[model samples]
Target: MRFRDGQWLVAEGVRIEYAEEVYRITPTPSGKGISLLCPTRKVMSRGDTLNLGTLSIDIEAAFDGVISVETTHWQGAIRRGPDFDLFPAGRPDVDAKITKTEAGTTVSAGGLSATVSGKPHEFDVSFHPTAGGKPLTTLLNRSVGLAYTPAPSSPMQLADTRIFKHYLFTQTTLSVGESIHGLGERFGPFNKVGQKVDLWNSDGGTSSDQAYKNISFWMSSRGYGVFIDTPERVELEIGSERCCRVQTSVEGQRLRWYLIYGPTPRDVLRRYSVLTGAPGRVPSWSFGLWLSTSFTTSYDEETVNTFLSGMKARDIPVEVFHFDCFWLKAFQWCDFEFDKDMFPDPQGQITRLKADGVVKKVCVWTNPYLGQASPVFAEAAAKGYLLKRKNGDVFQWDLWQTGMGIVDFTNPAACAWFVSCLERLFDTGVDCIKTDFGERIPSEDVQWFDSSVDPKRMHNYYTFVYNKLVYETLQKRYGTDEAVLFARSATAGSQRFPLTWGGDCESTPEAMAESLRGGLSLGLSGFAFWSVDIGGFEGYPPPWIYKRWVAFGLLCSHSRLHGSNSYRVPWTVDDDDQSDEGCSATLRKWTHLKARLMPYLFSQAQACVGAGLPLSLRAMCIEFPDDPTAWSLDRQFMLGDSLLVAPVFEEDGTVQFYLPEGSWTNFFTHEVKNGPGWFTETHKFGTLPLYVRPNTLLVLGKEGEKRTVYDYASDVEVRSYYAREGASAILVDNQGNKLGKLEVKNGEVVGSEVLTGEFRITVVNA
Candidate 1:
């Protein structure tokens, strides 16, 4: 994807040409539109026009508040099927106004205005914020083009694409001092300014550059966001391939990009979420801890009971109990039936677990892959419910399971067949399903149910369709507010399904840091809730590493205990370790803290669902973009716009984190510090750098409550920090009822209505 070696030279064996001259412009018959014959060379008299279908540009403000720029090469090619449903599907049609002047033609849509460079030197499509004072942002000045490799005369040459090697690419400048922030689940760094991110979802673990969820979108520090409206492998060179430009390329004839405007980065995400769908309302109890019988580890009904009983005996509360892969018989995955050997009476066991009071929520792992040994595989093949190749054969693979055929969610009958499996699980007392392995979709010569679908596009968009089927399945059965899934794969709009987790992280400090970065990046990308493996998914973690990660996991929007070869139960691992002398005690401490704070967490989550506030679980940069220092700090994050958390990533529990321009109050010690700078501190396993920003109000349940589900308004405490004039907070209970409001005037905290539920209030440095 990197074409340039430096500022002045292109890489070896690489050839790229850009659009230069505009020959003619034709208007669309329906709306205000202009299509230009933009070739790769300057048209001087008629001698320079030899090659055709090299490049063309279409400029239109088809939808209100959206500017659509489509650049094409090899025009009039047959279109493939699996493209993203962009602004056209969900928004109203607004007539764009075109005004021609000597300067250029301006197409105005709402407050956004686009000026196309005209006549003598046809070059740019520049945009301005006419409504606000925000500066200009350009889509492409002269960077739209086709890039390809010439067939080599040398023997070392390799074939690139079966179709013509030409691909569509566009580049736009990033202003001086501007920071770019997304391309989802990127674990390498916080600022994506100098990163080459290929939007390919792969199973390469968290230690590498590969990501599980690759959404082709980015938000800028300049108060706007850009979404490349294509699902075919979008290669993003953010100030990396070519300096000062975010170069986006896709392997296709046409490329579509949406330029979204907002006065702030948070507002940009708010508008972006409207283009795609917003996050759904997750269940209130999903905020509590989840314990799983780790993948590849042996487990049965006795093992499940012991894990549940162990947490209860230690006073560590768990809400969701997850059964990993072996819950179904080995190699017969997605049988949708619990292994009779492990669970003799599956329905009875689920009913017992829910009634036992220790574990009230239950989940099972399910993927779309149907194994050959499964009872329903033959039936599915007979019914044509499996994905097929162009040769009319089932595309079976032997990677995770022997002879596994993928379910074609795109087929309506296949979806009903898959939904029936889920209904069978729900017929028992299963509460949730962890939708996994949708990322390893095929991009070969595979045929989809929709005959016009493109395989390359479905490689990423497959997860969206897979997750949507199950999310709708749950919403239809359980109602909108009660549905949730512990999903492991996603795309641009897949955030509509709540609660996705970072997949396959190792048990190390470096992986822990990357997991946090991935979560923060996903939050900024538009997801409301996320989680990761508690200790990790790989090998057994060191005692100190396990203890540190537990604290970090408990603070995420969702929490689950899982691993690959080892169980993540604190006491089980602590039995053989020398480090983390208080491992069990530390796990208990954090679990109890998350349970008591469910009132505060659930309140913020509900508000985000009702009003489109871009998910409360956020990176500090998204919450405090005004502070330049916060833009580059990836090790820490701000929860719900008020609480700041710096997870200790070292074995000794020492971290250096920034507190952006505020009087930050530590959540544990209630110690207030004035910042806009960095602080270095060492903490025990029980404490990390969690802070509450100045002039905010936090509603918390009772300090020592053991159960996760409770009347949040009852016996609650409202904590006020640096409460000054005009600073106010409203308390909403778990059931979406307004409890009371708190206001501060002249450095005194006052209740608006003598707060009916849990009148206990604490003021910190007010």
Candidate 2:
């Protein structure tokens, strides 16, 4: 991935051909783009072009505020399948024009423009605002080229004797003080400087540089973003290979990317959603507390009922109950049959729970792989629905399950077969699914049912297909607005699936903060809804830690309590079982608070889906792009446009958070503070710092609301926080239908005719 050793040296056995001169520039056939032919060397004589390599570069407008640049070494390479499904909603029309002058050729689309220098012996592509300002980024001389590993001795080498791999790469300039973010659920540093990020989904937990969701997009602090348009592995050296440039390299002959101009980070995200797709809308009931039977824990129908009953005894409502991997018999994962020994009647249990109002939904764990021990595996293999090797044998691995073969979603019959499996689950009273473990897809020496797909490309793209198929099936069964999925792995367009959670993490404070970082990174990458295991996933969280994480997790857009070796039920995890301020009490308080806040939260969720913004745990940088300190803070996040949540990471409940220049009102204490500075505070297990921004209207549902599904328009409290005269809150019903708006008029809160709720208005800091 890194071809250069330093400023002036190439890595050993790596051959590089740097584009040195722009030999020719012509308009594209569409007349909306420019094409360039750049030779590796400056041609001083007519014969100098005879035996030199030339890089073909094309520049076009993908949409408004987005420009595409594709560089290729060989034009004859066959294009493969498994490509990204860009513009899934449909492409927008753009006003693109080409202008050629004596200096260069500039292609302008919307307000973005790219100018390529026409001077001989010089190669430069400068991207800037069409209205004219500082350039966003530039590709200088020797920045675009082809690289070969284990360099061939000569050009005349025979094809059978040659043993080498070639790569196409591009390096773009990074402005001073610029930081890069969002390579998909990254858990390392908040900023991606001095890091070599390989875009491949992995099963690595929260402490490693590897990520579970490896998206190919990164937003820069300099008001622009770059999206590598490939499903294959893309290695990015962000100021690591070259101190002043971000280098992107991919195996094969071609590499393409989109340069999106935002003037603002939020604008950049809005444009990105248009290019890929906006995040899907999740059901409103999913916003409440979800209790799961922890992985590897001894859980049966009795244990599940006991946990739900325990929560009910403590005044905590479990909106959704999930059964983790042990739901099926051991060694038979995708057989889709409940373990009869554990639960004699699985469907009856779900029915009883829902019938008794104990839980609203039931979710079960599944993956794209079927174990050989499963009877369904033999059926799938006989039906040619499993991935096969070149010799036509079913591919098998023992990493997660013995002889697990991946379901070949590339085949239509295989997809239908999987759909039938899901239909059976749906018929058995399962409401949703926990689609897990698509990150470990094998791409070596394997043959897909669709032979046109490159194995390497299918590695990360596998999650997209796997999740999309399941999501569509859910939408077909449930209504579009009623579908939800707790998926683990993802690629670029996987945001189209409703919800995804941060994968396995330790039960330490550091892991909690890292999980927040991962959610922030993913939020910046265009994902709308994200969650974390309430008390971490690997081990038992201490009472204080569990209490603290309960507050944090419940505040996420989607909350789920799950763990690996131990149950995450609050009563079981709390050390002081008799104390009133224990984990169970904390869980109860936060769950009720989320239910009360649903009026505002659901409205904000609707806005996020419409605008391509993250619903919960949004990075401060996205909302406060002008604040330099906001870009570096990852421990704290803005829950929506109004509230800022700083989770207490220390065992003593100490937390430090920043508020941009504004008057912030504490939601709990009702105390107001003016800040453009850092504030540290210590809280008990019951509460943390939750602040309301200035000039905002905060809405709340009925007090002591138990269930998440309710008439949000009825029995609501509208709180005003030193808001301007025009400040308002948009209201929606339990079914996500727009009702009306409540606004301030004549110094009083007034509602439109459609706002038929019993409104109680209170001014917090007015």
Candidate 3:
């Protein structure tokens, strides 16, 4: 994807043509946009324009504070399918005006404007805030171009026969102190400068450059965001190629992108969700702990019951019990049938688990692949429900299973059939489904049921349709605000699904930090809910690591205990010691602590659903955009808007975190500290660095409330910390319905009518 060798010379066999001059500018009929004719070279005369290529650039106002720029080299190429589902809810109207003066042409819309320079032989477009300040970014001369890259393995000796792939590229200026963040669940450095990121979904675990979710949107620390509008392959050189600009390139005839201007970083996220879709509403029960039967481990009906029973005896309530891939027989993943030999009766077992109150919900794992060993594969292949090759044969691969064919969700019959399969599971008392492994979809030599979509474009977009089908099915079965998904893969608009988890990771402190980085990055990308494997998913975590991860996982939006080859049950991992710092004890402590936080957590979640903000594990930069140090700190995150959590990443529990200018009170201990500084502290396994920010009112649930789903407005304790005028807290019930608000009015805390049922008011650091 890099075409230059240190900026002085182009890479071998690469030809580049820069857009040198703006020949003409014409306003569109809609009066909301302008198009520019840009030639590849300076047109000295009419003869200089002969035998040359011209680039057409269109700038349109999308909505408030958003404008799109599309550059095209060939305007006659056939437009393809599988485009992103932008503005899925509806498009908002904008107030736009196009004016031309002697100086130049400027199109202003929604407080943001794009101005085109009128100087001859100078191709310059600058985006600025309408309130009059420095430009956000500028596309200067030599910034827009097209390149011809030689095909792989082209012989150097046969220059006449070499083939080339064409691409359209644009580079936008980057300021000196601007930092870039978000590229869909990136596990690398949070600041993406000096990194070349390819937005392709892959299954490479948390330790590598491969990402399961690759969203083509990023926010700049300078308070603007850019969303590349393509599901096809996109390569971004964030200050890596030119060191002064962010270069974005895509193969094919045209490249379109939108620049969203937000006076604040949080406003940028809100506008992003308007273009894509807002995150779906999640159920309150999902905030509780989820226990999974590890993959490839020995698990039958008895084994599941024993794990549940041990947790119950240890006072660690498992809200949702998950059965991993072995629920179905080997090599028959999408069969959707329980192994009769292992379980004997799945419905009866699921009924007993729920009826006996051992677990409140049951989740089973499934994928979009149907192996040939299962009889259902033949039915699907015969009925044209599976993806086909160019020659009308089913596309089969042996990566995860033998002769596995992907289910074509693009086909309506296939989607209906998959719904029937899920309906059968719902009949068996299963409440949730873990939609896993949609990242490895084949994109070459494949023909989808919908023939209009390009195969290469469907590579990263496959996860969106797959997860959307399953999530909609769940929504139809369970009413509004009740559907949830533990999905593994995602793209731009996949945030419409309720929940997703971090993919495979190792059992080490480094992996834990990587999970945090990925979650924070994804949160920046507009995903509202995220989870991770408690003790890691690859190896058996030691007791200390397990206990440390338990404290961190319980604080996520959703928490799950899972592993690869070993069980994540507390007793199975910890020694027989029953002290307060043991694995079981630590798990019990955090589980109950989270239960006590349900009142505040559910309200935060409800707010996020409406505003398109992350409810849990929010990056520090989003909360404190003016603080320079907050943009680079990734080790800690804000649980909601009020509480800050720094996960202990060391074996000795030594941790360091930053706090903005405010008064912070320790949540575990009542000690108060004044900060706009960094602090380091050490503790045992029972606690980590958790603090409450200033000017906040925390509505806490009862101390001994064990269940996550209960009447949150009843029997709650209201804690006011440094309460200031105009400060308030919104309250909601278990079903995410607004109850009332506790507002600080005239220096007095007054509650609305709905804050009923024996509430106690406690003051902290007042």
Model 1 backbone overlap count? 0
lDDT (10s digit) by residue, model 3, range 1-766: 7878877898887878889989999886677899999999999999998877899999989899999999999888889979999999999999988878776888887789999997778999999997889899999988999888763343352245335688899999999999999989999999999999999999999999889999999999988999999998899999999999999999888999999999788899999999999999999999999999999998999999999999999999899999999999998887999999899999999999988899999999999999999989999999999999999999998989899999998899999999999999999999999999989888888999999999989999999999999899899999767899999999999999979999999999999999999999999999999999999999989999999999999999999999999999988897656888889999999999999999999999988888788877799998999999999999999998999999998898899999889999999896887889999999798889889989999988877888888888888988888999888999988888887889989878887567778888888867
TM-score of each: 0.94, 0.99, 0.98
> lDDT (0-100) at residue 389 of candidate 3?
100
Full-model lDDT, candidate 1: 0.81
Worst 10 residues of 1 by lDDT: 151-160
Candidate 1 TM-score, C-alpha based: 0.94
Q: Each candidate: how many clashes?
A: 0, 0, 0
Tens-digit lDDT track of model 2 for 187-300: 999999899999999999999999999999999999999999999999999999998999999999999999999989889999999998999999889998999999999989
Worst 10-residue lDDT window for candidate 2 reads 153-162
Better of 1 and 3 by lDDT: 3
List candidate 2 segments past 4 Å from native: 158-162
* Lowest lDDT 10-residue stretch of candidate 3: 153-162
Task: Rank all candidate structures by their lDDT, best first, as comma-separated numbers.
Answer: 3, 2, 1
Indicate the residue-level lDDT of 745 in model 1: 71
> Which pairs clash in the backbone of model 3?
none
Local distance difference test, each candidate: 0.81, 0.91, 0.91
In candidate 1, position 135 carries an lDDT of: 51
Candidate 3 lDDT score at position 640: 86
